[model samples]
Target: MMTYQKMICDGFELNYCIKGQGQPILVVGSSVYYPRLFSENFSQHFQLIFLDHRGFGKPTRAFKQADYTLDKIVEDIEHARQILKLDDLIIAGHSGHAFMAVAYAKAYPQHVQKMILLNTATTNSQERQQQSLSYFEAYASAKRKHQFQQDIALLEQDLKREPERRFVHMCIRMGAHSFYDYTFNATSTWDGVYPNMEIIDYLWGVAFAEQNLLQQIHHLNMPIFVGLGRYDYLVAPVSLWDAMECTPHVKKVIFEKSGHNPMLEEPEYFDEQLIAWINEG
Candidate 1:
C-alpha cells in the first residue's frame, strides 16, 4: 500500500508518496506520467518516496517562471527531506529529473547516500538533439511509418484543439517515438498521469536552457548508478557515456532491447541490477 503525504517546503505545498519499508530512497521528477510504473519493483527492497516538484501535482502556492531554477528545485527536495526527518537518503531520478538528482547530490552530498540516474544525460547538446531528430526520421521512414505519422498527426490535432492539454499530448507523442517496443498502448501508459504544463514549459523551456551539470558532477564521491536505454534517442545514448566519463565513481548498464523507460521495458533485469548495486559495499 502507498500512503500519500504533503508538506510545506520552500513556500510550495509539496506532495509526496511513501511505500515499502527498508532503506529510504527519494524518487523525484515527472511522477505525473506513469509514476508507479518506474518504481514498483524497487519498493520491495526499499522505502521509495516519490515527490511532485514545485509547480507540479497541485502545489499550495503558485510560482512564477523565475522560480523553476535547478537550485530552487533542489532546495525544495532538501526542505522536504528536513521536514520528513529523513536521513542520508538514496536519491533517484529519471530523464531530466535524473539531472536534478545529479545536481542534488552535488549540492547536498552529505544528505545523499547514493544516486541513480535513469535514461538521462549530463547536458543538452546540439549534436545530441540533431542525432535524436535523425533517429526519429529514420524510424518514421521504416516499417512503422504509417503508425508514426498517425501519432504525430493526432498529437498536432490535440495541441490545436486543446492547448491546455499540450503537455499530456506531447508526452504521449514522445512516448511513441521513445519506446523501442510500441506494443504497449501509449494512452494506457499515460493513464492516471496529471501533468502541469506551466511547470513543464517553464522548467524545460526556460531554466534547462541555462542549466549544465557536467562540471559539478565530478565533485560527488558517492556510489552512482547510471542506466541508459539503447534505443533512447530523446536524450541520446552517448549522454550515458558522457556521464560515466564525468563522474569518477560510477557503474552503468545499457538496456539493449529497451528505450527511454527501461524499468517498464525490462523490469526483471532492471530490478536485479538495481538491488545488486544497492547492496554493494
Candidate 2:
C-alpha cells in the first residue's frame, strides 16, 4: 500500500493510504479506527484510497463544539477530491463514514460516479417509523444509564476521586464495549487500536448530527448502494434498508452473518460485491 498526506481543511491534515492502480475509489474509515484496517486482498482490485478522518490518526486541532458535524466532514471529502483532481470517483465509507458518503453525494452529485454506504442508516427520515427511533433511543439510553450507575458506584467507593478518573473509566469502558460489540457481531479475527482523545471528542460531537442525516440522503442524486450486516446493532439496519428501498437510483445488499464491520469480517466477499456494484454502476 502507498501512504501519503494531504491538507484538506483548516485545523485538519489527513493521513491517507492508496493501493492498486485504476479509477480512484476512496474508502472512509469507521469512527474509532484508521483506514489501515482495510484488507490487503481488497486493495489489489480497484485502487483503494483509505483516509484517516480529521483528529484520528495524526495530530490536529479539533473543532471545539458542534463544528465537528458531518457537514464539515463532507466538506473535507470534497476538498480531498479536489486535491486528488478526481472525477467520476467512487466513494465508500463504513459506519459513521456512511453518513459522510451520503452527504458528499448530496453536495457534489456530479463529481461522484457511485457511492457505497456500509452498515449505516438514514438519520433524518421524516417518514421513519417511531418504533425505530424508540428502539435506538432505548438502546443508547440503556447503555448510558448502566454506565452511569457504574460511575456512581466508582465514585462512592472513592475509586474514581480525581476529575480525570471518571473520564478515563468512561473512555475505557466505552472503548471496550465498542470493540467487543464489533468483534463478536462483525468479525472472527481482528487487529486494531482505539483512537485517542482528539478523535474521541470529534466522534462524541458528531454522533447525533450524523444520526439525523436521512433528509440529506433523501436528497442525494447519485447512483448509490447500501450494504449492511444483518446483525448490526451499532446502526439501525432496518431503517437503512427501508431508506434504500425508498430512495431512487439506489440498491441494497445484506450480508446475513455479518454485523457492523462486514469489510473486516467478510473481506473477500465484501470486495467481490463491491466490485460487481462498481462495474454495474
Candidate 3:
C-alpha cells in the first residue's frame, strides 16, 4: 500500500493515492480501492493516480438524484484533474467506473491524451444483464455454477443482516461471476470501500444503462484501450464490444484466464498490452 491523500470538495472529499512515474493516468474510481487493483510496476511507464468519483466518496449532507448524475460525476473528475494540475492525462477506469472515465473524455477531450477501460461492458441495461446471466449458464463450468449457486443462496441472508452494507455484501457474494477463480475470496479488496447505494444504483442501473456511448466515443480522437476478460460473466458478452466499431483508435484486448478485474487478475499481460498501447501513436 502507498501513502494516501485527499482532495476535499464542497460537500464531499475525494481520497487519492499516488505512485509510479512517467505519463499521468487518472483512474476514475474509489481512490483507496482502485489503487490496489493495478500493478505497481506501471510506474515505469506511467504515473498512476487513483482518485474517487463523487459516488464512492459518500458526502455527509443530503443530496438529490440530480447531484450524482453522470454529468455531475464527470465534472467531479474534472475537478480532481484541475486540482492535481494534471494535463494531457491518460484517463482509466475499471468495471462501472469506466463510464465516468469515458464520459469525462467525451466531455473534456482537450485534457485527455488517451483512455483505458478494463472489464467495462458496452452498457448495463436489463437486456445486457440478462444476457450475461444466460452466458454464465451456457458457458460456465459446472463447478463454477455450483459455487455461484452456493454464494447466491447466502446473499439474501447477508443482505438482510447488513442492509446498510447491501452493495458490499452483494459484490462479495458474487465471487463466482466476478473472479475467474470462482472460489477466490475478494472481501479484502473491498476492505475500506463505502458505497452510496442511491448513487451507485442510479448510475449503474440508469445512467450507464441508457448511455449512447458510441456516438460520444466516435468524437474522441485519442487512442483508447478496452480490456475485457473472456471469463467475465457479470457484464454483457465480450462479443458485443468486439462486434462494434468506433472512429477512435479503440483497441480491444482480451485476457483468456481472467474475469471482471483483469488488471488485478492478469497484471503482467495487462500492463504489457496497456503500456504498449499508451506508447504507440
- Who wins the lDDT comparison? 3
Candidate 3, 1-281: lDDT as tens digits: 36578876657777888887777888888877777788877766777888887778858577889888999988888888888899999998788888888889888999998888888777878888899999999999999999989998998897788777788888888999988899988888888888888888999999999875555566678888888898888884788785545444888888998999888899899889888888885
Candidate 2 lDDT by residue in tens digits, 1-281: 57566564767666667677777888875223434446776667678777766635444554554545666777778877888788899998776677667767877889988888877655534334344445545554455446434544544443335332333344333321333233232122213333445445555444534356556666677777788776554455355566457667777878765655677667778778877877874
User: What tens-digit string does per-residue lDDT give for candidate 1 at 47-145?
Assistant: 888887874655556767667677888888898888878888899988778767877888889999899888876666555567777766765436444
Candidate that beats the other on lDDT, 1 or 2, i.e. the better one: 1
Alpha carbon lDDT of each predicted model:
0.74, 0.61, 0.84
- Which of candidates 2 and 3 is the stronger one according to lDDT? 3
**C-alpha RMSD by candidate, in order:** 2.4, 6.0, 1.6
Cα shift from native, residue 262, model 3 (Å): 1.2
Poorest stretch of ten by lDDT in candidate 1:
30-39
**Using lDDT as the measure, what is the rank order of every candidate, best first?**
3, 1, 2
Q: Which should have the higher lDDT, number 1 or number 3?
A: 3
Candidate 1 has a TM-score of 0.89
Winner of 2 and 3 under TM-score: 3
